[model samples]
Structures are given as structure tokens and as C-alpha cells.
Target: MRADAKKNYSHILAVAREVVTEHGADASMRDIARRADVGLATLLRHFPTREALFEALLCTNLDALTQTADELETSNSPDEALVSWFQEWLVFAQSYRGVVAMMAAAHTNPDSALYAACAEVHSASARLLLRAQALGSARADMNGDDLFALMTALGWAVDQPSFAPRADRLFQIVASAILTNPSSKDIKNATR
Candidate 1:
């Protein structure tokens, strides 16, 4: 892209990020265009569709989260790495309000614009789960898909005002359930 077009693309992405963070997966394309001070045609020229726009907005952060999994794999213990990555995944899933549904759909849909990025994230998460399972720390029956589903559920739960306050406790419960042997801290945290 030309320098000016590139600048506009970046600006639109920035504004879309803000809009999505506020309004979620249903954020209006027209609103995003208006907020970015661009024509709808210009925004559509860059993104083409809502999925395309979100793919551009989230791809960088998704890649970074995958890289974090890679780092944690080598630097942390298997259980610790898995737990840490789980937390990170939850944060990413909740970043843009109702984005978890998009992520879950993207994970299952090969044709989705976000599919490749979501696949990478899932693979990274699977590797962490494998490490923990091999160490006999995590449940052998639970695979990456299961973990992904759990994270998606927790992400949705926390998005609800009524359930938001229990997010941490619910996280500990799920983490403990995934692990074969819960740490004292994990058990205590879950109960609280």
C-alpha cells in the first residue's frame, strides 16, 4: 500500500479496535468508519468485511500470545506454563467484549478470516497442555480443544455482570479440574 493508504489503514484499525472494545463483535462498520473519519468505501476497501477487519485488528496480538506460549514452554514448569497460558488466553478472549464467540467459530471454520490465527493459538495451547499432561500434572483426557472450550466458556461467563465477580474463583476451579493434582493454593483459591 502507499504511505497515505497505509496510514489510513492503521488509523482505521485503531478506531475499530476502540469501537469493538466498546461494542464487541456486533460493533457497527458504519460507526467504525465514522469514528475513523473515513468513508465506508475506504474502510471496506481495506477490510472488505467485519471478519477481515477483526482479523487485521487481532492478528498481531494473537501472534504475540502464541509467542508467549512458546517462551513459557521453555522458561516455566509444565504445569505453570499451562496455567499461565490459560490465563493469557482468557484475557485475550475477553479483550473485545463478545469476541469469544467469534474466536470459537473461527477455530472451527476453516474458511473464516480469523481461522489461521485461531489455529495457531490453539496449537500453541495444545503444546502447553501436552507438556503438562506428559508431566502428569494435567488431565490426560483433556486435549487442547477441551481447554479451548473451557476458556471460551469462562470468557463468556466473565462477560456477564452477574457472573463477573466469580471469574477468578471459576478460573481456579477450572484450572484445578484440568490438573491431576491441584496445588494447595489452587484449591484454596477455588473455594474462595
Candidate 2:
């Protein structure tokens, strides 16, 4: 890419990040272009679709989360690691407004732009869940896809103002349900 073109791409991505943070997954491309002081055509040239733009924007964070999951597996006990990663994943799911739907869709669609990133998250989640289940702490009936769906539902609740206040409580409830034998210390450590 030429210097000017690269500069424009970076600027557009930065502005899109800001816009998405404020307005969420449905944020308008035109508005992002306006905010970046770039033409709509320029924005479209760099990101042909909304999913592509979000995939680029969230790639770093998703990779970091997956890496964190890897580290937590070795550093924490099975239950604690699973719960800790769950909390982190939940926070990431709620980072941008209305992104849960995109994640949910991408999770099942191989052709989606966000599919690879979401799949990585799903795989990491499965590993943690499996680790916990191996220790008899987590429920054996559940899998990564179930956890992903739960996260999506919780993320949806967070998008609604009224339900936002209950998200934490709901999280605890869900966590408790996932863990078959959560000790007081485990719960305390996980929730923190």
C-alpha cells in the first residue's frame, strides 16, 4: 500500500473503532467515513463489508483473549480457569454494542468474515470447559457451543438497558449451573 493509502486505512480503522464502540455492530459505514474525514468509497474500498471491518477491528482483542485462555489453563485450577475465562469472554462479547448477534451468526457460518475468530474463541472455550469437566467441577452435559449460546444470551441482555443491571447476577447463576461442585473458595476466586 502507498503511504497515503495506508494512512487512510489506519485512520478509517481508528474512526470505525470509535464509532463501533459508541454505536455498536450496526454503526453506519458512512458515519465512520465522515468521522474519519474520508470518502465513503475509500471506507468501502478498505472494508468491503461490515463484517470484514469488525473482523479487522476485533481480531487483536480476540487473539488476546484466546491467548489468555491458554495461559489460564496452566496457571489456574480447572474450575477457576474455566470461570475466569468465561468472565473474560463475557466482557469481550459485550464490548461493542450489538456484536453478540454477529458472533452468534459467525460461529455457525463458515463463510462469514468473523467465523475464524469466533471459532478460535469457541475452541478455547471448549478446552477450558473440558479441563473443568475432567476434574468433575463443570457439568459434563455441556459443550463449547452451549457456552457460546449462553454468552450470546447474556450479551443480548447487556444490550438492553433494563437487563444490563441483572447481567452480573445472571452470570453468577449461569456459572453456578455450569459448575457441578463449586467450592466457596472457588466461587470467590472465580467471581473476583
Candidate 3:
């Protein structure tokens, strides 16, 4: 990509994140172009379809989240790392309105850009789950696909404005169910 093209791509992504989050996954591409101060053609050139733009933004965010998970896996205790990653995943999933639903849809649509990103995110998540499981902290029977699905559900639950307050408790409940030796603080936090 040329310098100007790269700049446009970056700008479009930034503007798209704001517009999409505020307006929804169905936000108009023309609105994103206007917000970015770029022509519709420029936006279309970078992102031909709504899905393309969404994939770019989602992939960028997930990349950062995955990086954080990798770092946590190395620095934190296995179980703690898993919890931390899940917490972060919850945040990531709940970032934009309807993002969880978008991910869930894309996860199954193998032809979609979101699916590739979801697969990568799932792979990263699996690493954390596997690490905890290896230490006998997480559920022994769990797999990456199941973890991803559970997380998608958690994300969807957390995305609701009313359910926001109970998100931590939800995480704890799920974590406890998965962990052989769940922490007391998390358990207590769930109740509080």
C-alpha cells in the first residue's frame, strides 16, 4: 500500500469504528467516508463492502486483544492468565453495540472476513484455555470452539445495558464452572 492509501485506510478504520459503534453494524459507508473526510470512492476503494470495513475494524481490535492475551499468558499464572484473558475478551466482545452478534454471525460464515478473525481469536483464546487446563485449573473437557462459543454468549450477555452490572458475576460463574479451583475473590466479587 502506498503512503497515501495507507493513511486513508487508517483514517477510514478510525472513523468507521466510531460510526459503526454508535450507529451499529448497519451504519452507512457514506457516513464513514464523510466522518473521515474522505470521498466515498476512497472508502469504497479501501473497503468495497460494509463487511470489508467491519472486518478491518474488527480484525484490528482483535489483533490487539490477542496480543494482550499472549502477554498475559506469559506473565500471569495459568489460571489467572485465563481469567484475565476472558475479562479482556468480554471487553472486546462488548466494545461496539451488536458486535457480539456480528462476530457470532461471522464465526459461522466461513466466507466472511469476520470468520477468519474469529478463527484467529479463537485460536489465541484456546491457547490460554489449554494452558489453564494443563495446570488442572480449567475444565479438562473444554476445547477452543466451545470456549469461543461460551465467550460469544458471555459477550452477548454483557453487551446488554441492563446486564452490564452482572457481567463480572457471569464471568465468575462461567470461570468457576470451567476451573477446578476457582478463586474466592472472584466468587465473592460475583455476589457483590
Candidate 4:
């Protein structure tokens, strides 16, 4: 793609992501185009339909989470890295409340991009889980699918308006459940 075309595509995706996250999957592509300062033709050239755009947006977020997980692997302890990655993932999930729904739809659609995006998330999360388990910080039996399910449950909680206030607490509770010995309290007191 040309420089300007690439710039336009990036801008459209960014704006579309922001709009969809705030307004939901039903958010208008025309509005996104206007926000991106791109024409309808340009937007369509990049994303032919609403579902296509939504999938691209979902992929972008998943890609970012994967990159962050990769970076966290080197910078933090295995347990801390897992916790940090979950925190970031939950935040992204909460921001895009419709993601769970989209993923479910993707599962049945066969042609949906969300399926591939979800697989990417799964692969990245599995790496983190395995690393934590290898370091004896995470439960030995916990697998990638289990972690993914836990995340989905937490995301559902985060999506609820009533549960939103307790989202952070919920994350801590889930983290505490997965960690091996030396509970969060013990680890915190030890550090102090």
C-alpha cells in the first residue's frame, strides 16, 4: 500500500475501534470515516463491511495484547507477568463489551475473522500460562483453555454495569485462585 493509503487505513481502524468500543458493534462506519477524515470509498477499500471492520478492529486489539504479553515475559516474574497480562486483557475486554458476543458469532460463522483472532489470543495466553506454571507460580493443571474460560467469565463480569465497580477486585480474586504457594497477601507482606 502507498504511504497515504496505509495512513488512511490505520486511521480508519483506530477511529473505528474507538467508536465501536464506546458505541458498540452497531456504530456507524460513516461516522468512523468522518472521524478518520477519510472518504467512504477509502474506508470501504480497507473494510468492505461492518463485520469486516469489526473483525479488523478485534484483530488489532488481540495483536496488541499479544505483543504486550511477549514484552512482559522478559520484564517481570512469571506470576507477575501473568497477572499483569490478565489485567491488561481484562481492560481490553471491558472496553469492548461486544467482543464476547462477536467471538460467539464467529464460532458459528466459519468465515469470521474473530475465530482467527481468538486463536491468536489463545496461543499468546497459553505461552504466559505455561511460563508461569514452569516457574511453579501457577497451578500445574491449569491449561490455556482453562485460562481462556476464566478470562471470558471475568470479561462477562466486567461487562455488567453492576459488576463493573468490582472488576478490579474480581481480577485479584481470580489471580489469587491461580497462584501457587505464598498467597497475594503473603507475597505483598514479604515485599514490604
Tens-digit lDDT track for model 2 on 130-158? 99999899999999889888877877887
What residue pairs are clashing in model 2?
none
How far residue 162's Cα lies from its native spot in candidate 2, in Å, is 1.1
Q: What lDDT does model 2 reach?
A: 0.87
Choose the strongest candidate by TM-score.
Answer: 2
Over 1-192, each residue of candidate 3 has an lDDT whose tens digit, in order, gives 999888878878988988988987778889889999989998888888777787888877888998998898899888888877787888777677777888888888998768888888888889999999998998999998899899899988988889888888888888788778999685454333
lDDT (0-100) at residue 1 of candidate 2?
A: 98
TM-score-wise, the better of 3 and 4 is 3
> What's model 1's overall lDDT?
0.86
Encode model 4's per-residue lDDT on 55-165: one tens digit a residue. Answer: 887776778998999998889888877888887788788777667666645644667757777777777788999999998999999999899888888887778899988
Off by over 4 Å in 3: 37-41, 186-192
Q: Give TM per candidate.
A: 0.94, 0.95, 0.86, 0.77
Measured over all alpha carbons after superposition, the RMSD of each candidate to the real structure, in angstroms, is 2.2, 1.4, 2.6, 3.8
- Full-model lDDT for every candidate: 0.86, 0.87, 0.83, 0.79
Better of 1 and 3 by lDDT: 1
